[model samples]
Target: MSDSPSSWPDLATLRDRIDDIDRQLQVLINQRAECAQQVAQSKMAAEGDDTHFYRPEREAQVLRQIMERNQGPLSSEEIARLFREIMSSCLALERPIKVAYLGPEGTFTQQAALKHFGHGAISVPMTAIDEVFREVEAGAVDYGVVPVENSTEGVISHTLDSFMDSSLQICGEVVLRIHQHLMVGENSRPDKISTIYSHASSLAQCRKWLDAHYPHAERVAMPSNAEAARKVKGEWHSAAIAGDMAAELYGLTRLAEKIEDTPDNSTRFLIIGRQEVPPSGDDKTSLMVSMRNQPGALFEVLDPFHRHGVDMTRIESRPSHTGVWNYVFFIDFKGHTASSNVQQVLQDIGEKAADLKILGAYPRGVL
Candidate 1:
């Protein structure tokens, strides 16, 4: 009954103060959401116009500003994620979004989808990249998540090829740092493992580690890393290379962590939707072009970017499928197509190349 200042504060009083703060927060959040509802209504009145639904550029600028001014125990990434959820909730107030990603559940691509869409989104798992695209194109899903490139292994050709025919636009992107774990069932012994299974890319990424440890074990490839984890239930002698989330989902024990060949191995995923996204201040545009199978065709394709002082971030060539000698080039430029310089470069490239298609422009993924 001393009521000393150092005595632990009364539990009921603290709870009441917390409740008051919560009530204020609720009121402010509701006010902000009411503004979102009004924006949605104005958008609907525009008829066939989508300007009010979302603004990627504005969102990116806002996140950058938050990160710049952030001073806290939480990192910029954590702060950005919290804001992303708030923005996602606001967008949901306008309309619920459906997203599709390659999966049977617990795949890395699924994680990327959730990161981009937030937990409020309706996420559907498709079996393949093309399936995700098909769903997006058919309006079965509002967006699709597909892996475009990996740091160690280069591009996913199937994903690039799928873009050749799809009309979907790239609205956003997410980069996930891949950490491979050597997982086994609870009863399994790491030293006694005889075989390992994983997706081809995962296997390749961890090849050196596997060779050093399980030199004699048979390495098998599966459709996905998640499948590999699922296949190792009762076999004490078998292990799988998978992500930490997959291991937890499959109830597998981690024998080793960060088993990838490189410390910085990451995969970039594209967010495909029907609507074009406004420039996110920091944005990247992707395009594919087929040039005449002749000397300097590559130079002709890229010269405009240099002449216009545009930065070319990535350029890869794949077989055109027209013949043995033909090739198609996929390029990633550091600007949006809506910009004047980028527009001029695209116009010049189109006139020079045999074929040119702007895949989509999207916000650059921040690591």
Candidate 2:
């Protein structure tokens, strides 16, 4: 390992070596894919037509192991990402999966879906989170991805509420680091930009940055960042605040990148589907509980978790649609429902709550 250029192989020699490595990689990848096909065949032989090709827990475990064992020139996350696509393509060769996400295209939800399921899986865009759930429930798509919360913007109430009426299970989670940019189309006037368009959340996220840069501009909230990017395509005096995906998709130039007030802004998305995901060692369980409108009702519901040593990660309250209960609490805790401690905690909470709904236990986000 010499730092000197003289000790390095010549350009042609290095390229030839790279070509040899690429050939080896291709052969190994095909071998892995063939193994996956054989695994599918084995399952189909045993389970007949009901064989499920995608296993969220299994995939999560594989990715985690890949990251843990990696000692490479590539970062762990980068290495895991490469393996994710490899596994995704292998899974697709067995049976291609379909994912529905809230989108008009180029939105973060779509990005999350692609990040979690990989580009190998087909992604369908829907108008709303409810529609995403509906499509997964109706068997139109194999899975759905919906935004659960943002680090800067807090929880998405619509997504939490959707779980109350839907029977879909949380199969996995994806965490995407968000980077908002001020973009303008080729036809737009960047110098005299008079109006800015974005989703309400994006506008809020970049409020401080916009105030510092374009305080005089009128802000218009669209249904989505994608729609906002679409709107500025033909406008000479307008810019859109959106992510890189939207800008690239709409062929817009980013005038100001990473414009969000918070430097580490990110969003977490949930994968929903008809089938339940088994324990992946590292897991989280979400629960919707309605406690009796009485003194210490919340404490009573939470005390069991403390006693059982289950780590509660997040808690949010939403007004109950039913007149019988005043409100419902959405709780997320670390650990799978199948674990003995989690089972005990849930049993204890079940006794104290007016209504209890275990949304699903799913693998924690790996990237």
Candidate 3:
């Protein structure tokens, strides 16, 4: 350590350099903010009083470009997050947007909301998924974020059914890596875990881990993981299973971490809003198709996508509410509705299916 003292900076010298760099960064950041404000003014001048300041498609493109050009000590998500906050601040300067997510705070949906909209957004916690949908439908919030599917647990049926009742369009999507942890409050008896609490899905997710570790412990299901965390604080002989966000919020200690059965467990969330997003270069379109009850109905509905060379990403079927509405399928595929081939595919599928509704076309998750 002493040998390279001549070429290396002393502690004081390094501190001084850091201070100078920070000052320069602060100045540049303010300059960027000023430019963003000017952009707002220009948009107002051109689009009048009813200008839409937040464009999910445009934001996705910017984040994608930033990620693509990054050559850093930080990961792409880190860089994109830094930019997200900057954009959040700039968007606030123009006009702040409200985001509604399924939460009581400290839920994964809340984390996803902050991830997509940044900390500057006014994110409200809704009691249920339908509440989030209603908030967006009533224009109470600018957008809503809800879980569509999880890698390990499969599709979120509630979210899919919400689309059937709501007119909101899908504007963007975010995929969050889920890490469920076993946590205990400060006064909890770690050795005497008589009961464990978590959401039903979360409990199912960590079933094997629980079976091996706390097989004799009483497994209780709650409304949400966050609620479990909240309850664990008052129960001395209990523990809660949740994520880092909930643990931090409830001041709980982690007894076990990332206990999900799958190593790469993740959940896909959709951003729903009133506005229709124009095509970003890379986009995915979601649609709902109700097929007639017949032998080849499923194949007839999907055959059009194959014939048009339209790439299908996912397809999930839910039971129809009515007799004629035999099979309801939620389909996600590449390309926008505006594209000719996609239009042709839709036309073909419309003929085959009893009913077809284009849910929305949106930019693919970039970060």
Candidate 4:
């Protein structure tokens, strides 16, 4: 622990120590994998074909504990992430999981999927958000990941609207910090760039930066940032606004990095699956409520939450296809459906609303 070189171990000594630690780590990792396999075997014996290998709540608890017990140079998030991959690998030994996301690869949604499920889960790219939902609903994939909202751009209406007709439940959530980068293909000149392409949300997220630096350049919105990067690959006078993954995938050079207007620009993604997630102690419940076209209806819907002391985090309204001027409210609250207070609040709101749908009660984002 001394700062002076004289008190520190030599470089060779440190290397040997690290090698010994690495060997121990390898054995421990394999032991964990063996334990995971045993867990799977136990489940198969107890429940036969009905066994559920992935428990969102249990994983959340484990990761939280990992972060809490961490005492090292690595940050809490960093330690948690390391354990995340370890858990992911162990779970794969039990049973590999397939995940679908809105993408052609190198998209933020794909990153979110990988972040939440780790590289062990097979990630399949879908062309649209709705398609991602369809895949999960049809049992083509075990789960799906889709953008729910952004810190800067607000709610993703398509994802919200998709929930209206889908039976998929929110198993978990992922919050990914978005970093926008301006990049160009090898053939493109930095000074000669006249057109820029990116997803609409990415473009909006970096609007101010673009105005300042590429004031005269044309901004074209594409299907996704990855697509934008792909498009610019053949254009000499165009550049792409995307993330590091996209840049690396398309072999583009960053003209500027972290160009988003907001420094903490982030996106929240929801994990959609068929099974309901049990309470992870810390959880969030999402609901879709429909109200009759009447005065004070919104107040009636919200009054119960206030009365029950339940913290409502977000509320977004979308037009209901059922009737004219009808709207559906998507509400997220800080508690599980199993909680007594939440049950009481739901009962009160059920009496006031035309229809109440429990979208999902899921663990809050851990990473």
Candidate 5:
């Protein structure tokens, strides 16, 4: 009852109160940053300069705690993101982690990298997925973010293949809601648009929408959505299909939004790093299993997971380079590799499997 309209503060009074709160928030945030700096100094003194200041497990636990304790007008994710940015800034005060993503900039990978690492991270855009892997593998960057799968379009085979060749371990994961938009340059006329440029995957995702609305338009596939956005900058009768970030980056205007066939079209990305992430209590493990070409070989690989009471989250098969008809199983399951149940099943599978590589057990995406 005390929060009734009659008891509400006036506009001037409310603005003044908000201003005071903002001042307090500014001071507290900087104080936290200073403490982060002190912590960094303490870590360096104790463990030397080679110490890792950015702990994915610790960050995940902190975000989960923030979400669990949150009971407010704002959504849990909204508050978690606020805390994420704060942590990001504080982490930068300690040391900025350089992350490489599959990008030319303004792409979905860039968005995911920023979402998981926050703006404080230094993001390096690589031309290809393999390049992203190479950067992380070579220690050129602290981490790499690459798309693993999309809900609508299925798996990104290139990313998986890159992982097969690389030695980098999966450290974390992030799921991004993919929002495809039809955008155009400032001089482009809506009525004059006859051609659309986008990546092959984007075009496929929006196939139904294209059939319904712009069936006659020429659909050209490019290297990336950002590249498509780049190409359309000088053309009058051209438009690009990309995300909001690309539109803002190239000064393009959105003519249509969310044109993907599935409403909840989302992509899951993995954070690849050199060091293995310690268990965050709540975690998921990804592994690649290979078996000789034989009947029920798939069953042999998956049955242990079933019998062990382990939850297998995803499974995909990719061609094995060793032979023409051979295949490898890429699997994701819930549980840390260090846990008893997971370790038991992994050991059992290793015996029957031609080769089993523990990719890494990492905290599931918190935001």
Candidate 6:
């Protein structure tokens, strides 16, 4: 063959250049890991304990600082995600972490678990929320991620109830913006859809849209959105309401995107583990309190927060199962238990309330 007149370089020369680039990247990654190893060593030495391993607070602070200083075409979040994986891998080198979440896979809870632990650690998906907590408490998993509250639907009561007597501590937290999607099989026709399937919560969130479009269609509540998507195979007359990840997992097509009732809908998930996380500068503490059914009883419980200048982020009451007209209040505040102000406030509240339990203290999620 005649020599081709081309703008491209020779194959051998291009291959050599690519090899050199790969070598450089490899070297840089190793150097970063070595530095992380040094950090682990230094932390261990300072504590005078060789058994102590990874420090999540220090790792979070490092990622936050990198995100803060990051200036490039890549956004801070993108940079932080990359560093998160790197640190996760390094931590695995020290000790492999096991995480549990509610799932058969592809659930938002699984996504939150991955967000906290990255791809290096082991993730176990339980069939129920209580199973996640039980796994953590039994030491089957190093951590667990469970839904705490939804911006639109309010708190997940099962998660709260599960923690009432569990010894597991909340080590971290992650908030995921929930974007519901209309998914169908490849052979399914959007206009021909006659029925829909989804978890009760997911169906409720998309109630308005479903009512407008498929008012006459049968709405079936499945165990989970993933299960719903899996049920509708090639039926052109059926559709499922689920997250994008669930659609992808089940090989379904997205008929519509971002179909949630509210644009700002999001769900916050808690990461439960045995160890208590140190303050990440910006942190939140969750507590569940049972107050006596008396006038101004609630005020007396909250008085300590106001006196200490602690900002209350959220307060919601659930019917106490003990008897008629009884209630338990769940409170979230913008401070860590490790902080002096929060410690004093908690002490005061502890003395005033009938019962109080610190659920967890974790870094605030990045919006």
Clashing pairs in 2: none
lDDT of 2: 0.91
**Considering TM-score, which of the candidate structures 4 and 6 is the better prediction for this target?**
4
Candidate 6 C-alpha lDDT tens digits along 160-182: 87877687877777888878898
Model 2, runs deviating above 4 Å: 1-5, 151-155, 179-203, 206-264
RMSD of every prediction = 5.4, 5.5, 5.3, 5.6, 6.0, 5.4
Candidate 1: where is the Cα deviation over 4 Å?
1-17, 48-52, 151-155, 179-203, 208-259, 321-325
Clashing pairs in 1: none
Query: In candidate 1, where is summed lDDT lowest over 10 consecutive residues?
Result: 47-56
Q: Model 1 over residues 175-249: C-alpha lDDT tens digits? A: 888899999998887888898999998999999999898899999999998999999967899999999888989
Q: Tell me each candidate's TM-score.
A: 0.76, 0.80, 0.78, 0.79, 0.78, 0.74
CA displacement after TM-score superposition, residue 235 of candidate 2 (Å) = 22
What is the Cα-based lDDT of residue 119 in candidate 3?
90
Candidate 5 residue-wise lDDT, 142-217, digit = tens? 9999999876544479888877777889999999877999999989988888999999989999999989989899
User: What's the lDDT for residue 356 in model 4?
Assistant: 89
Assess each prediction's global lDDT (C-alpha) against the native.
0.86, 0.91, 0.90, 0.92, 0.90, 0.83
1-367 per-residue lDDT for model 2 (tens digits)? 5888779888999999999999999999999999999999999999898778999999999999999999999999999889989988999997789999989798778989988998899999999889999999999999999999876555488899899898889998898888999999898778899999999989999999999999999999999999999999988999999998899999999898999998878888999998888999999999999976888988987899999999999899888877689879999999999999999999998888889999999999999
The true-versus-predicted C-alpha distance at residue 259 of model 2, in Å, is 9.2
lDDT of 2 at 299: 91
lDDT of 3 by residue, 64-178 (tens): 9999999999988899999999899878876788999988899778999999999989999999899999999998899999989876544389899888877889998999877
Lowest lDDT block of 10, candidate 3: 149-158
Steric collisions counted per model? 0, 0, 0, 0, 0, 0
